[model samples]
Target chain A: MSKEYVLKEVEFWDGAMASSQALRQAEVDIMAAYPITPSTPIIQNYADYLSNGYVDGEYIRTESEHAAMSACVAASAAGARVTTATSSQGFALMIEVLYQASGMRLPVVLNVANRALAAPLNVNGDHSDLYLGRDAGWINLCTFNQQEVYDMTLMSFKIGEHKNVRLPVMVHQDGFICSHTAQNVAPLQDDVARKFVGDFEAVDSLLDFARPVTYGAQTEEDWHFEHKAKQHKAIMDSINVIEDTFEEFEKLTGRKYNAVESYMMEDAEIAIVALGTTIESSIEAARQLREEGIKVGIVAPRVFRPFPYDKIADALKNVKAIGILDRSSPGGALGMLFNEVTAAIYTNDTKPVINNYIYGLGGRDTTIADLKQIAKEIQANADAGKLTTPVQQFSGLRGPKLSFFDMESSK
Target chain B: MLEIRWHSRAGQGAVTGAKGLGDIVSDTGKQVQAFAFYGSAKRGAAMSAYNRIDDKPILNHEKFMIPDYVLVLDPALAFIGNITANEKEDTKYIITTHLSKKELLEKLPNLDEKRVYTLDCMKISQETIGRAIPNTPMLGALMKVSGMFEIDYFKNAIIKVLSKFPQKIVDANLKAIQRAYEEVV
Candidate 1:
């Protein structure tokens, strides 16, 4: 831990509203938004700040989320720092432009209040939206609470606009859990935050009349593959840029953040890997289980996009068995997070038996009691010296038992 | 650590009450988290807010499954919403009801006789503020029961947070809080 870097009195703020404050401090030149549940407060607060002279910018209320993202792409290409907020179906509506923002190499910041995608038409927190943008070629950051929401929103502008990593970034927080929950937030002075993010530098902007640049050009079969390959390289190589930004932020703010956060992992025999607010409860569960003589630990990947494979594998190297918790609905296949984690640790020397457990989709509550029960079950598997049940299961889902990948059937 | 669950209607100020109490607790340099359940954001619908106060940072963001204190801003919600689900046996119920402690205990089967406390917060709020919100009075009753803050501390906090409002509104809320503090039994 570094020395506390607070320069003013701490204020209580919820995650959504604080996100707006961070965006205001960044002094974004343009924001195009369409309001959506749990995420509307972000843009709403920013609009209020702009109108109250707290920020100098343009807030455009668009007709639809698609138009909102489209305007962001246009403003960003025209050499303006741009930002927006969306959730659930709103994110789904912007899917096409999400690719455009990344493909055109525009560094637009998006605050995604993670919410459940609608088929049953429910509005609540889930990873469906976060997962939807995973393959859209944007840098993804996960925050557990209000502090991270403020800190990471500032850090995102730095990482996404870095010359080496000019890709849009999505800072995700669980819907109601973080977005609506109020907590203490120590905000940096406006000038300090502005200096930390630094001045916006446009690489190849449409505003440069002398040096004409063409955007949205169709890269047919001849160059599409090569263009996409470079974009892939840029995102894959952003890990270094992200770490450097984290280091600089820590130096300035005295708050230390890691790519993969470990909780009681040292000498842990049973470890659970999760994301978002679920990690919060899992940590509490880990502490209680430790007192009960159960060697339980938790691993959470703070940076979800470039999916910190090596860091997470190292964190769980000593654990005997791993429980990978995925919050998104898995219709016919294994959970998205489970697939990525298993691939990350596939080549580890210890080769711990990792299982997939889907929980908390559609805002179903995942409590400490549920986590404790999972820890006990995974502990039982480790003691048996072999696989005890199916490798994949839906945890905490009400109704009859549902399990995938039966070990016996696979054999 | 203290965990509380507040029950009220959507138009009521349970969410605001949770934040107001959090403001006072955090003023004492303790960590606090305040949040409400999102159920369509419709008016007059049953809604709930939660608070967690501790000397250390709070980690659990899930809704309260077992709260130490349950403050009911609307007495009818106690039975209508099953507000006492998954509560501790010793959980204290500070309710805004015209019913006496004996009468409230008789009505709310889930509440223990010794732990239940009643206050006519709605009546006080209507008399002072001319609104039936009852959230400010409930906060006062909570402050009295939990001893979480001095009465003066909350009074100053109320003034600070509502400094932008009209004097009558502020004065009425302050009066409601004082009356609830004196009348909770």
Candidate 2:
């Protein structure tokens, strides 16, 4: 499309330390980050930003993730906008303060580069990070690529800082896919981005320094439930704020994205579902099937935290079967996303036999062939009218096909 | 609508090239979507990405299974990933390799003729930037094949995108892109 923009090619792995330089272009005023596998860049980036006068706010090098988020609370509470990033373990560590920030109604934004939390010592992309913290009362949004990471980071400030949604928001990007992959992102012009975002000042309240009153007063259990109600109200009320933020972002960027994006499933019998980076490959598979008149579609989830049920179910209602693709290991259960899709689709009247496809685990590569195979299998299974367990596993090439651990650990 | 699929490994600059191409095309008033299909593969793993430009809003966000244009960043991966099968009947194959376009076509006996446009960005990259990264140089070849965007426009776009980097690196990249843009037929 002949529109006015610049493009260039860049490398993905410039070392973890190089990542912060990318974010520094945003002119981040305040940042708090703690080290975690693959996600160390968030903190590393902020550290580099600190040494130079690259950003204006306090760069807190906290000892722990809990402290990192606590510092963000302190900074954001004092009326200076703040940013912090974390991964699986770090995300788990920051969980407590996550509730604290949301409950206090601080408009702090956190970028979650999702990774697997493990006894296996994994440092790859997975949903475990975001899923573990799903109920923590934060706006969770996933970006499929590095460009979206930058765009979402810029957009989050506007969304979180919005007057209507004074709750915290978590912008989630895949750990290695977007965080590590170097691509030719058209980093927004700083002045233009700032102008589009406008200036952010703390919503003045009675707690203004001139007036002098403390917020987040300890609530007694007798009325603590009611105090929690206000926070819940903010979470529910944020849907509108999130929508308005996206509307404004679309206006500024001329690129539109929704909480859920659908591709060519209309009048189709089977649907292949996914989110983030996996959408690209799945669409290719869908195109192949389309040419064969196999009739397939895809629904990529954009917002997993609020769990956009209405959007997902309404989109898939016409389909006869849906294949759910998840990038993370569900362990004994199923892929985290597959479980969520099933929960969303379980109640429909004209029900489709949804086949949950678990794949791309341990940071493995999922290709169009893998997706195409799953699409065909799911279609056949649905046509035969016999599918069970809500998940049809499509595993990649097992180097040795042996279960190495094999109950030896139990002994 | 021009649907181009770029095949490269995860750490390669294919996705960036895709986005840059989309950015350049947008300058010509077309709607475009630049996205990558990545696996859990680490940095050295093979990956496929894409760029689509059209006169209208693109509803087909899926990778162009039948791509009008195919950019093979690492020629070796053309076989490993079976990228050859994704090529359409009359698709343009702009590959980065040491072999000439004719030589490259002969190498892939199963692949068709006429649509083939092979380039050795490896040679061009070494001559210009002194590095093996042929992303910008291959981008020049893509510009030549498509006529979707001008070489000068892409050169300007490269300077703007890489302007944030050091002057030496910026100039090297500019030279690499310029050489490919001008030399590729």
Candidate 3:
């Protein structure tokens, strides 16, 4: 029996609550999850909804994240709409199974409250876990705030479960910052949201005995390369479906989303390329800089997995200099975002002076002041029409200024 | 933008108070953000929660702030929590303590006497709500000090926010809010 839940036009919700509510409205068949910091509330709230009769879904309390993802994979393969949430170390544990889920073409949804990986065992927001899973064959979607967390969670199911894209999707939100912070979120009515998400369409379901289909068949070297190539093509081709889904959602909700979100980029001279919650903060900084007559803007990849290289290049085409901010530690080289953005721009005619900024690791606060300083540095580069600072620098890191790759010295 | 900070112990309801305020503020079509820093701290450990209210969508996600108002929910935290950190020149402090404003300012000589407001939220919650949870009473005091909303309007909004609780508990919280609203100085 479903309980009477009066839907509000809008409500105050944290990122966790927003995502959990979306999961509930999607009416997922199974949620197998192991609790982790920051992400615990998402599954916890879903479990509460399940017990209270608001959602007719099964909540499996697995012992570990590995077991949780394993359960999700099993359920998804068995033709159940499956989803779960995890962060940090738990995400690392689930990495082994993430590839399996995608390789088997199971459209499972994983909500990752992005956190820093362990060394001193920190439980704070960063992109270390997000960066770690970039190559796991899951379509990654990044969110800027609580509202996007809800919006993207709903869209993830539609995009991943599309017939053309039968692959898993990961929605990333910065842990603590977005997950724990309460803010205003306008959610779709239950009936409308349900209609938008639609029902789970099972293809080659394991439960269908009459059609009995085999999954996870070992291809070995004979057909493995071809299989992998097909998987890559599916991921690349899913971009169209993702765009259409975004458009449909916009039509229903009037909130538009783009493959690459550009803010104040019209005729801008310098730009900050970033992701997650930092994008909003950088936009605020850029707005303040604009008051001082500085032509600074922000560009962020809302869809990170298929990597919208063309959109990113077009967004930054008019800028004279760019700063790519990555919130994860780059063990020995330039940041992942820096590498990707530069690769995208390398094919373009307008070659801007690009610099990498590694920042906000292990939950360090990325303040408006720090972002303003970054924009000023980019402006300096734009004025000089060449690289003025090191090719890469650390933002908000303590102690003496740490930087690398002095192009001048190399030259 | 209106920024506020709360200093309290982990068990105390600073996070809840901040979120409750956010809920009430958001109802008026204003953008609000409420969050806390939880560094794996246990109950009885010191913690802080924060709120930001603005007319436009808040684009800043940084925890750093020069708070316009500082709320100290635990009496002991008044002395040790560095409640004045990053406070603006016109920042108002609403503290929960049995001590009078003069006495609190005397003990913490650095505080501006004109800006300090004190009330016994712990006692009010104990007497009215039948518990020592001072967070609701602190909200009442903040309502009186900040005057961001009228007493009756704020209480009704909070009543809606606490609709999940039993009628008896909700009534008690309303009384606690009313008492602190009148008694805080």
Candidate 4:
């Protein structure tokens, strides 16, 4: 029996708590998770809800991250609404099962509070975990703050559980920056959110013994290629379902979301494409730089999986030059976001001079001063009709200047 | 928008103080964001928390550069980090210190006396809560300096948040807040 929760019209919550509240509202069947920072609060709050009788769900305390995800797969295949959360190394440990969940077309929603991987051992916000899960075949969504963390999570269930798109979804937010930061969030009424997410339709659940169906079947070379193509079609078909869900959510809450969120891009000659909280800061930077006669704008991809290439390309179709900020550390190469964005716009007629800046790895701060300098460089490159310096360099690097991968050839 | 920064040690209730202030302000239909900047600090190590309040939605989630006010929960941290890095023209500093305003100016030699407010928050916390957590008194002092919210609102909010605690603890915090509210100058 699901107990009704008395949710405030508006409340103050951090990102993790907001996500946990969304999961509570969804009335998930099972949450099998191993707590990891800064995503620990997502699971902790859910566990608290369970203990306090606020939510009706089973809270599984697994031995490790791998076991947590392994339990989620089992629960999902058995026709249960499954969800879990992890970050950094925990996410890396669950990487193997992530593919299994998607390959089996299980609609398990995972919340990932993105954190930097350990090498010299650091626990801070970055996109290394996000990039690591890029090609895992799950539908990926990005949130800027607490509000999106709530909204995107509710929508992830609908998008993943749709009949046309039976794929797991991963909802991500910056680790400590978004997870630990307390802010205002206007949440939907419990019944309104419930109606919007609707009911889950389990297709061929393992528990339906009357029509016995087997999951995780071995399709050798005979049918392997056909099965893989069908999986790819499902991911590609999710785009329409995602759009429809966003529309339905907006109609209910009056908050609209897009696959690609653009700020001041109209008539902009220079633009910066970034993700997560950086988009909000870049809006401030664009406002400040505009006063100094710089035609700067900002572009952010709200959806990373089934990558929003067409929307991203269209947003930058008119800009003269663009700068792509990637938070993940590039191991002797360019950042993953830079590579994806370049591929997105390579065939476009705009052919803007693109520059890739690998930044904020290991949680280094990105200041407005750095953005202003980048704005100036993009403006200069636009006016000169060419890149002024190296196409790719590490923004906010502490040590001596060193650009990566064919950067020397540019000089 | 009014942005404020708080400086304190790791175990000194900085995050809680900022979050408390956020909850109070947001209760009055205003928007608020409270966050901290730390590099895995241990107990007694220096850390900072930031608060941003505005009538509209807060878009930028970055750290503050030119905050309207700076509240120092520890007098010792003033000498280590750039506590006074960026401030508006008439930025206020509500600090916890044993020294008088005149003596604090003499020690710093750089701080202006007009905008500096000091109170013995440690003594207040010790006498009331039986600890060195000066955040309550500091908030009390901040309410007086900024005048963003009424003193009663803060007192009531504190009481409400600490409602689950023992009445003695709640009463002591209320007394600490009241004493600092009247005592800071």
Which TM-score values does chain B get in all models? 0.94, 0.88, 0.97, 0.96
lDDT tens string, model 4, A119-211?
978889999999999888999999988999999999999999999899999999988778999899989878888888887778888899999
Reported per model, the fraction of native interface contacts reproduced equals 0.62, 0.03, 0.82, 0.56
Candidate 3 yields a Cα-based lDDT of 0.93
User: Can you list each candidate's DockQ?
Assistant: 0.73, 0.09, 0.89, 0.64
TM-score attained by model 3? 0.99
- lDDT tens readout by residue for model 1, A1-411: 112223335777889977988998888889999999989999999888788777778999899999999999999999999999999999999999999999999999999999999898878898999988899999999998899999999999999999999999999999988998998888898878989999899889898999999999998999999999999999989999999999999999898889998988888999999899899889998888999999998999999988899998789888888889999988888888888888888778886767789899888888898899888888977887556778888888889988988877433
Proportion of true inter-chain contacts also present in candidate 2: 0.03
| Global lDDT scores for all candidate models | 0.88, 0.71, 0.93, 0.88
Candidate ranking (lDDT, best to worst): 3, 1, 4, 2
| Candidate 2 lDDT tens digits, B1-185 | 67778888776688777766665665555666666765446886788777766776443433335788888888787556576665566888777777766676677776645476777777777777777777888888887887766777778877866766788877888888777777664
Cα-based lDDT at residue A254, candidate 3:
98
Candidate ranking under DockQ, highest first, comes to 3, 1, 4, 2
Tens-digit per-residue lDDT, B1-185, candidate 4 = 88899989998899989988887888889999999986778899888899999998887666655778888999887667577788767888887888988888888877864488889899999999999889989999898888877998789887876777899999999999989999999
Question: Candidate 4: where are CA atoms >4 Å away?
Answer: A405-411, B79-81, B87-89, B110-114
Candidate with more favorable, higher TM-score: 2 or 3: 3
Q: What's the distance in Å from true for residue A266, model 3? A: 0.4
Model 2 lDDT, residue B27, Cα: 55
TM-score of chain B of 4: 0.96
- Runs of candidate 2 with Cα error greater than 4 angstroms are A1-28, A35-55, A182-192, A203-207, A213-220, A388-394, A397-411, B1-185
